[model samples]
Structures are given as structure tokens and as C-alpha cells.
Target: MKLAMKYVILYVNDFEQSMRFYRDILGLPVKMEAGTYVEFDTGATTLSINTRESVNELLGLGLTADVPAASSFEVGFVVEDVAAVIEELRGQQVPIVREPVTKPWGQTVAYITDPDGHFIEICTAVG
Candidate 1:
């Protein structure tokens, strides 16, 4: 089977806050938005955010627990300079999970968490 469209839907606790983090802070263009649902154009893939209440209603299941506490999954953004991005994020008061550092594979990488506590990585390849 072949895929026509790819999207990563994140269930966020606060819809507006998450939207601001992606749309305003990250500067991703909004592809579409309807009430509590928002989709951002992330080049090849789409990143969407939906309220947890909407997700529970759609699934017909009631989940009162907080957002999932998992760090194994992350959305990565490729940038030209990791340090410059980190500095910008710092100015925006975004939480920095890890400082920009060169990895063993010759790539500079940094980590930050979104409003929903989802991991986001900013990276750049080094020669």
C-alpha cells in the first residue's frame, strides 16, 4: 500500500497554547484550523493538534488522565544552525531540554518540549 498523506496528530491539554507554540513560536504555517483542531504544514508531513476532549469524544472513551509521559518519541526539525535556533528559543522562554551539542555522528542537536510536553528536536549536520 502507498500513503497519500502523512500527519502526526498530537492530543494536547491546552489547544490554544499548543497552537501558539507551533504556529507562533515554531513559525509553522497553518494549513487548516477548525475550533479545537489545527493542522500545520511541515513540508513533507502535516503536524496537527487536537484537544484531548475532542479525542476522547471521537474515540467514545473517557480518559481523565494527564497527557502521556513519554520521551521516546519526538518530532525533529532540520535547521541550518542549531545554536542560533536554541538562542531564539531561549528568548521566547521555551523550555530547553538539552543544550545544543555536537553528537558523535557529526550533527549538532538540541531538545525542547512543547506546551503539551512533547519532545521536539532541532538539529543540524556538521562536516
Candidate 2:
């Protein structure tokens, strides 16, 4: 079967903090916002955030925001300039874990984390 990805939902601990980071700092437009869940309009695949309590209530699974030390996956955004984005984030008092760097393949990339510790990658388009 052919599968298409629909959304990436982050079960965040602090809903308000994560919302500000995504909506204000990262500057993603809100597509939909309910009391417990918020979805951002990010192309075909929607980037969303929800509360931990809702996940357990809906899925019946004890989901928590206790992320691992090492990130298993990252939500990446393709931007015009990685350095510019990093600078903007810095000015907002957001702690950037990694500065922009050019890889051997010639793509500039940087790293930052959201309030709930989800790795966010800011990079230029792939060659």
C-alpha cells in the first residue's frame, strides 16, 4: 500500500510555551486551533501540537513529553538562509543549540529545540 504522511503531532508538556515557540518565534501560521490541539499550515504535511492529557484520553496510551537525550527524529524546515533564521531566533532570546554550518554537500543547516525539547532543523534547499 502507498502511504502518504498526514501530520507530525508533538505531545508537548507546556502547551502555551510550545504554541508561542511555533506560532511566534518560528512564525508558522496557525491553520486550526482548538482548546487542546493546534495545527500549523506547513505545506501538505501539517505540523501540530497537542497536550499530553489529550493523547492519553484519546489514544488510551500514557504518552508523556519525557523525550530521550538523543533525538530520534527532527522536524525540519526549508528556509532561504539558515544563518538569517538563526539570528532571528537568537534575537528572540531563543537558545540555539547549534549554529549554522555548511556540510560537505554544500547545504547550510542549523539546529534548535522547541520548549518541549523537539529538535528543529533549519536548512537551505537541497542541491
Candidate 3:
């Protein structure tokens, strides 16, 4: 049997700030929310955010969102215009990890980190 993915959740330090980032900044609609957990509608899979403190208390794993290193994975978004989205994000004082650049494969991409230090890639569809 093959395993199927359901939802992706990022345990964040500040729940309100992260909700603002995805809800207001990135323009993702909220699909569901309960307590400190939230799920965003991405038109495909659901992207979720929750408090690290809650997860730790529930699982006893002692997870922390304070790591200084980059995570091994990134959440990517395909947009119509890379530069326009980047400009909008910059206006909200979000720090850009990389300016929009066209890759050799013909996709214009830029990078930014979420409130939880998760890498978010905004790019144009590959042509």
C-alpha cells in the first residue's frame, strides 16, 4: 500500500504572528482552527500552524522553534508574478532570504522565512 500525505503543520513560537503571516501576509485562507492550531487552504493540500509549546506538552518531545540553522525542507508556492509578490511581502517588513532570480530552468523564484523560521519559496510556474 502507498502512503498518502494529509497536512503539513509547522510548530511555531508565536501563534498569532504566524497566523498573521500566513493569513494576512501570504493571503492564505483559513480552513480550520481549534485552540492554538490552524489550517490554511492552499487549493491542494492543507498548510497548518500550531504552537510549539502545545506540541511539546502533548508529546513530551521538547520541540523548540529557536534553532539557528535552516530546516531541511521548504514550503513552496507557485505564483503568477514573482517580483510583484516579493514587493508586497517587502512592504510588510518581511525579510527576504533571496531576491527574485530566474533560474537556469526558467523559473523566477524568491525566498523568505515565516515567523517560525520556515523557508517559504515564492516562484513563477516553470515554463
The TM-score leader among the candidates is: 2
Better-scoring candidate (TM-score), 1 or 2: 2
**Compared with the true structure, what per-residue lDDT tens digits does model 2 show for residues 1-127?**
9999999998888889989999998889999999889999989999999988888899987776574632777999999989988999999988798999999999999999888778899999999
Q: Candidate 2 at residue 77, lDDT?
A: 98
Model 3 error, position 88 (Å):
0.7
Q: Check candidate 3 and list the clashing pairs.
A: none
**Per-residue lDDT tens digits of candidate 3, residues 1-127?**
9987778988888999999999999999999999899999997789998888998988887877776533778999999999999999999999899999999999999999997678999999987
| Cα RMSD for candidates in order | 2.0, 1.5, 1.5
lDDT of 1 by residue, 1-127 (tens): 9877699988888888998999999999999999899999998889999887988988966644464753559988999989999999999999999999898889999999998788999998457
- Candidate 2 wrong stretches, greater than 4 Å: 67-70
What C-alpha lDDT does candidate 2 achieve relative to the native structure? 0.89
lDDT of 3: 0.89
TM-score of 3: 0.92
lDDT of 2 at 95: 75
Order of models, best TM-score first: 2, 3, 1
